[model samples]
Target: MELSVVTGCLAGAISQDPEDVIQGGDVLNKQASASMEGFLQANAPPETEVLGGPCEESSWIRPPVDFLKCNWDASIDGRSKKMGMGLVFRDSSGGFRAAAISNIPYITDPEIAESIAARWVVSMCAKLGFQSVVFERDALVVVNSLLSPSPCWRICGGIVEDTRRMLHQFNSWTVKHARRSANQVAYFLAKHALSLVQDIVWRGECPSFL
Candidate 1:
């Protein structure tokens, strides 16, 4: 907000060498402000408006910040009859932001596990009141179907549709594919759920490593 004010003032200035003035101590903040606004304005369409919070120009950035990492995963083991899901949200710095887990009895395929994980992600974003969300999954089939969704994939159809509906409430959100190596934290969170002997519900902390 302060940036917006200064940027406008600098752009209207009556001074010669405004760039030089900007480089000097008195108006460096104004230059930085204009530059940042320029950055914000670059990505948004000119027609967008701000009803609250940030204007569309600056809204693409999600906080819990760029240093924050957000992703999810599920474990599907058809032969072993185990299914589990997890979400791990962290600041880019790798600190634990938030984590959740669920164990389901419908253990017939890895597809089911992945679908449930996607559903959980949308639900979590809504529950957290996140205005901007970015979800990552390692499963290409799942991510592709989500981006250009299919009406099939019936194994978790109801949950999939529910997640899609929840997604419409956000101002900005993205879902994409990530490889296993890039998705290790969420992968491990789901893996940890499979390691547990007891069924558990998501609670406040990072639940035990079991």
Candidate 2:
């Protein structure tokens, strides 16, 4: 908020440097006044208007009974042009079933990386013999594309087709999107891939970071 006010003031002034416009005393005084106002507003009676927190954070939800839930994520490093895909499988009761991290070389596009993560998770599920599963991801574009297959884009077409084939292999399967907050475990694993020289897999339980 202070930054917004300072920016607004700076926009109307001739000085382009923040140091010249953001006076210490003015900022301090304004901040104190704003804090007091916020405090009173929050502590005000129920009838009074006060700002409240944002909507509740999205959390991981368990899959249906007898089904497995797979949350996958991909991390791409721009500098090295490397991509890492991470996926964690959990039972309907939310117990960890398995997790894997794959570090791929020379992938710069985030969309393709996300698609690979999806395809990789499906392949993992097939090897694990999970007949019924739901694949969850934070990438809405990939999820939408998977739900509605199109031949318009040639990029990752083979990977997309491979994922479709794997999906059909399962008796019951689904692909859906979840907020990044709900997919923290997979995100952590994707970031963790950067430190590994080869793919890593964990069975029955996950690492301490989870």
Candidate 3:
């Protein structure tokens, strides 16, 4: 399957024809992974920590689920820099809900941040124990890919799937595209995450500080 995907990418890039696109089922389809890898690598944000290490859940501190909004952000590690992703969730009244910020190993490009953000949202949402909530993000590619009919990129597809699993936890939920200005909370959180040199700290009034 990877071979097929890579072929597809090779076809698209090497084509001498101006009006050319990778034909459906073309052997070039195999190149998708290779192309996507390079694309992801080239487009990835700057460098950051490689997450997915063992994480600890703090029962002491807690997020206010009923706070009215939720936001999530993640950074994609580029070769030497990191690209960031931010998401905000707001209730019908448009107040605070929940917010998250995370960083993952560098890949290559910005678009990959979408999937990382998507997966991070799911993981964070689950941890947050949000029963019913709306999801929002600044990455159109992530949102559009989720909404798109074409099968999402298989690797990124897992992030979408994980997001779907988290969605099941919400009695009511929606994913919406939001402008950067509207997603300030999550963006701050993501950017703030970059400040930590040895540990992660949460600001605002989280009960966990208790």
Best by lDDT: 2
The sequence of per-residue lDDT tens digits that candidate 1 reaches over residues 32-150 is: 33443443355233332212221122112233454333577777544445655657665444455566555555454555666766876777666655555566666767766565545
Model 3 RMSD in Å is 18.8
Backbone clashes in model 1, listed as residue pairs: 67-91, 67-92, 68-91, 68-92, 69-90
Instruction: Encode model 2's per-residue lDDT on 1-210: one tens digit a residue.
Output: 000000111011112111222222444334423533442354112332212112222789888898888888887666555666678899988898877766666666766776777777877788767877878877777777666645526588878877766677777767777778888878766765543454556666444445
Model 3's TM-score against the true structure: 0.53
Off by over 4 Å in 1: 1-69, 78-80, 92-95, 153-155, 197-210
| All models, RMSD in angstroms | 21.7, 19.5, 18.8
Off by over 4 Å in 3: 1-67, 75-98, 148-150, 198-210
The better candidate by TM-score, 2 or 3, is 2
Q: How does model 1 score by TM-score?
A: 0.58
Model 2 root mean square deviation, Cα atoms: 19.5
Cα lDDT of model 3 by residue, 32-115, tens digit: 224323443441123311112111222111223443345455554333354443344455454444433334434335555567
Better of 1 and 3 by TM-score: 1
